[model samples]
Target: MEADEKIEKISSQTLISNSPSKRIRIRPLTKASLVLRGTLVVLVLLTAYTFYTIDVKDVNFVQGMIGTAKNVKVMFLEPHLSHFSFSHALYQVMITLGLAFLTTVFGAIIAVFLSLFAAQNLSSKRVSVVIKGFAAFIRAVPTVLWVLIFAVAAGLGSVAAVIGMTFHSISYLIKAYSESFEELDKGVIEALQASGASWWQIVFQAVIPSSISYMISWTFMRFEINFAVAVAMGAAAGAGGIGFDMFMASSFYYDIREIGAVTYFILVIAILLEVLATQIKKRLKVNI
Candidate 1:
């Protein structure tokens, strides 16, 4: 019988009287799901209330938008030279890029060694669990917060920025790398073990070869994240960069025009990096 005809039987059965043989089986809603739905409803209500409270004060949305549109000429058409010079903006942007590169490279290096112990397939379950817990703690903290914490010890600058960003980056890489290692061919590992291959030899010849592509892909993804953090740190942590220029323009509303130029530069650089990463990943896959 067709599925459409099948629904008629159930519907007709529901309309008829219940019996021991024909009793409808109703699944009760789980308490967890019920609570989840209730919580979501409460959150939505709170959000709506907050929006109404704030929106009342800014009722002239159209007028505000028109005013902002007029400012676009000063903000985007002609931008103020950041720090009153082109060289300064160039130098700062380079520093931000360098900071991000250093953090990602250092983080990936540290993670490579740590991931061996963190992978349950390679290491004891107890060891992997413990290592993962530590990484989880670090991952739970925001990258910007880590930068600020390290800034207290390292002092505010690129040094603190690199150290903080690398700290979070290591945990990020560890989670990505260990997961990739865990997915390595189980049969290959078993065969290597049967042949009495040492751990180091198996890792280099088997595990590494099998998972290098995933590791590289994860590293590139993390690099992009670190670059964004570096830009934020440039302004927040006094680690001079184009981000600082942008921050300055925002803080001093008179120089809002310069912000447009700084924003455009950042947008271009980000787009270029994304395209470069995609090309590199494609080439890496082809080579593999």
Candidate 2:
């Protein structure tokens, strides 16, 4: 009874004390948020205006939609290769896979070293900032644009594709790897330093081992991205792969069935790559 009376008296006193205080106020939107909202509003208005002013030339919407449905049906349901044999398609797929693999391997190798400078814990602030800034610039450029840029020097072929893809991959993996390295416990690094361990020794013994799993995960993810990019490069840069076949089928032959077949092949390979990555992670006891 005493405890309950005490609680009631304290609650009443708190309420009475709080009664004269200002009510809790909600925060106003920040400048960044207001800017974002304004940008969105502008984009919406522009989109609406563009659509309102757009002209359609001699096309019936219902007929167009029906034709699209038919094309989709033919592409997906009745998919079969017309010009190329299954073996040829498979070989082209292997070429694309090779490009992806080569770029990934090269990028991983280079990024591992570059990331040492990019990681704040491992490098000085100026070095990290410079490296990260360069990487950001590289990443800002589209992979296709890079390929085209390099194509001027390397000429239109696998060489340009590989160089461009690897360049982008290196930038991407550097960011990923540096972030992973930064996630390392500071105590462990400090302990290594106190033990009179050399920088190289500490990196090899502690850093690499601790972050190997993350490195593997990022590498595989980049490989997957490179694979998709390689496909586009095949057509765009004349790199010559299944993507070229896909382009030819779609544009020149207008063979939806062939396009569909190539699509299925790519899809199957993607699934297999995912499964392989999962298995490797499991084998290595990598949780991530």
Candidate 3:
């Protein structure tokens, strides 16, 4: 009788504990919530309307791709295989690589310096605001405009493309580097300062080391962006890179074969850069 009473008491307690409350309440949406929902619905409707009017099927994408493939086959099997020397194509590739290297290196150096001024924790309030504004101004201007400016000032060739890429890349690099620096542990900086380290020493020892992985990742990402810019400006400025060749072929209504070849070359370079960046991230143990 005692054991049964104890079991019944435990079961009753469990049932009581699990029971839901009898109270009921209703919550109404705020004005802000209703406005946000209405805005989102309007935006979705606009997006759908825009998409519907685009006529994406008019070009027959599959047919165009088949045509491109045919051109590739002809270019590879005929004139490219028989008449053209590999050395010519190799030279264009080298030019693109050189341009990319120069712009990325120069831009990264400039960005490192600018980042010091732009970082909120590193610079005075006035300096930080000024630097941020300047960076924003640089970013607001399109690369095409920069290319035009440099082309007129520097007078064409790879020089213009290099300058254009470097100018635009500085803005991107500064923003990325500043953000990375900001993400560093504040406690580490505080400890270093407490130990009587100078600003430079603290930054070099505590901040940079902690943020090196992000720095490298940003640099690689900027390189890819600058490479594309280089290609575009190279063609526009008559810089004799692969882009120049591609543009020339298009201007003369030359066989799509030539255009396809140049495009393939660019695609291959982009793929290689992506693979190399991935490997670097792995080696550095940088988690994105």
Candidate rank order under lDDT: 2, 1, 3
Task: Tell me the tens digit of each residue's lDDT in model 1 across 129-156.
Answer: 9999999999999999999999999999
lDDT of 3 by residue, 133-193 (tens): 8888989999868877898888887778778878888988999998888888778888988
Off by over 4 Å in 1: 1-33, 55-59, 69-74, 80-82
Q: Is candidate 1 or candidate 3 better by lDDT?
A: 1
Ranking by TM-score: 2, 1, 3
At residue 20, give the lDDT of candidate 3: 71
Give per-model TM-scores.
Answer: 0.85, 0.86, 0.74
Off by over 4 Å in 3: 1-84, 286-288
Clashing pairs in 1: none
Task: Please name the candidate that would achieve the greatest TM-score relative to the true structure.
Answer: 2
Worst 10 residues of 3 by lDDT: 77-86
Query: What's the residue-level lDDT of 9 in candidate 3?
Result: 100
